[model samples]
Target: MIPWVHIDTGTIPNGGGTLRLMRRGQEFSIQLGQNELMNSRLSGSEVALAELACGRIAARSGARVLIGGLGMGFTLRAALQTLPERALVEVAELVPSVAAWARGPLAEVFGGILDDPRVRLLQTDVAAPIGAARAVYDAILLDVDNGPDGLTHPGNDRLYDHGGLGLARRALRPGGVLAVWSAHPDAAFTRRLRDAGFTVEEVPVRANGRRGGARHRIWLAARPDGAR
Candidate 1:
């Protein structure tokens, strides 16, 4: 059997962990430790989540979208293709090394989209934009840290909490959509979305185009019209 080569990427300040890119022949994986974060193996669900998020907000002009995490740029690219010319996308990525990899080694995965005019890639946490903004974005799509139940960073757990959900609610326009991609479903989290004053719905998605394989869940939440 061929060995998987490990390449040192860099480190994250907040997490106090080193980033490594592992490659074995045609397959590539991103890992913070023993746990695998994302891979090139399956991305159909990611694409579908992007589409679902955009569909709810594409009706409006001058749409402002915030994409949490820029994994391989599949979500961003799909959004760019769906949104109008007047639309803008701000992608917040916590790890600078992941951004570097997208632009440097894994450029082919996104076809030089790191430099796309529609995309504003920030090397910061997604919570920053979510907290700082004031009812600006029409859509906020988050695929960070697997899901509400899965915590990649101890701090990321807050993003699923009431406070973080409140921040996300404040950052979005009235009737705006909050779409989250998860590896699986969490009923408790769905209830939390409703408690946050959002109309929540769960959609099961597969990671195959016509031919299905692994299944994932996408949670769609819409802020109330009177929600501030």
Candidate 2:
């Protein structure tokens, strides 16, 4: 077995917790306490989060996207691949070290996606942009925490709550999509999406793409075009 090595440790902002970077040969992992937040090898669902959301807005010109959480940059890379050159992707990351780790120890995994011209990296809470906007983004991709049932920050719960869902709906342009990734499914959260006036679709995906791994859930909630 290739022994795992501890590379760096980061403190999550607002008392979220500590994030540790561990490496086993070429494979890297970001862990919160004992729980693994993300692994370099398992990026299928993360890729899908961007693919599915960007696919929905493929026809939009100069599409703008807001991606919450820059974990490993899988979603960001995938989004860049799917969107056109004119598209702009704003990545909000509350923990600054995660971004540093991407450029530092995890540079190879990130593949220089952060340096892309379309990417705008923001070291602030995603909610700030979401709250400050009014029908601004074409798509909002959230792979934050462990989905609605977050593990790192207590404030993350607001991002999944009814009020938060309403904020997300308002932040999105008409027919814009809000995609969320989760380690598990929450039926109530599904209900919350519908209650927030979004057309929701719950998708089950593999963690390692087609090869198979853990089954995860992704919620694709679309705001109606006629909605104000």
Candidate 3:
């Protein structure tokens, strides 16, 4: 058996826990404490998060997408595949080292997707961009801190709160989608989305595509046509 080897460690930014990178033969993993945040082998649900959202706005021209986290580029690659050639995908990664890991030890996993013209990677909190404009993005996707309570950064709760949800609502154009990925289900959040004026749909997807693995949740919330 090939034993797991610790490759590197990085701070999660904003006083979050330490992020450790590990490798066992061909597979790689990024973890915080005992929670495995991401692994090279399990990317199905993450990809689904982008496919479900971008699939909705694929036909639109000049589409813009804001992705809150850049974990191994699975979601970003899926978004790139789903959207049109002219679309723009902005990935806001709270930790700078996460981006560096994407380019360094994890480069093969990304397949050079970061070099795509449609992508703009930023090393900062996602909230700034989400609140920077009104009705700008065609969709806003959040994979931050595993469904909003902050496994890494405590402030991530704001993104799921009424105010943060409102900010996401305000940042999106009418009919835009807000897709969020979570490790587990949270029913209260569904209600919050409803109160925030988004038509919400929660999807259950497997971790390793159709092959079968742990299940994950994805919430697709759509801004109303009449919403500002």
- Per lDDT, the best of the predicted structures is 2
- Give candidate 1 misplaced runs (Cα > 4 Å): none
Go through the candidates in order and give the clash count of each: 0, 0, 0
In candidate 2 the C-alpha lDDT for residue 128 amounts to: 97
Across 17-121, the per-residue lDDT of candidate 2 in tens digits comes to: 899999999999999988999999999999999999999997799999999999999999999999999999999999989989989999999888998999999
Taken over the whole model, the C-alpha lDDT of each candidate is 0.84, 0.94, 0.92
TM-score, structure 2 vs. true? 0.99
Instruction: Identify the superior model by TM-score, candidate 1 or candidate 3.
Output: 3
- Candidate 2 Cα outliers beyond 4 Å, as residue runs: none
Model 3 global lDDT (CA atoms, 0 to 1):
0.92
Order of quality (lDDT) = 2, 3, 1
TM-score for each model: 0.94, 0.99, 0.98
| Candidate number that wins on TM-score, 2 or 3 | 2
Ranking by TM-score: 2, 3, 1
Better of 2 and 3 by lDDT: 2
Q: Write the per-residue lDDT of candidate 3 for residues 197-224, one digit (tens) a residue.
A: 9999999999998998998999999999
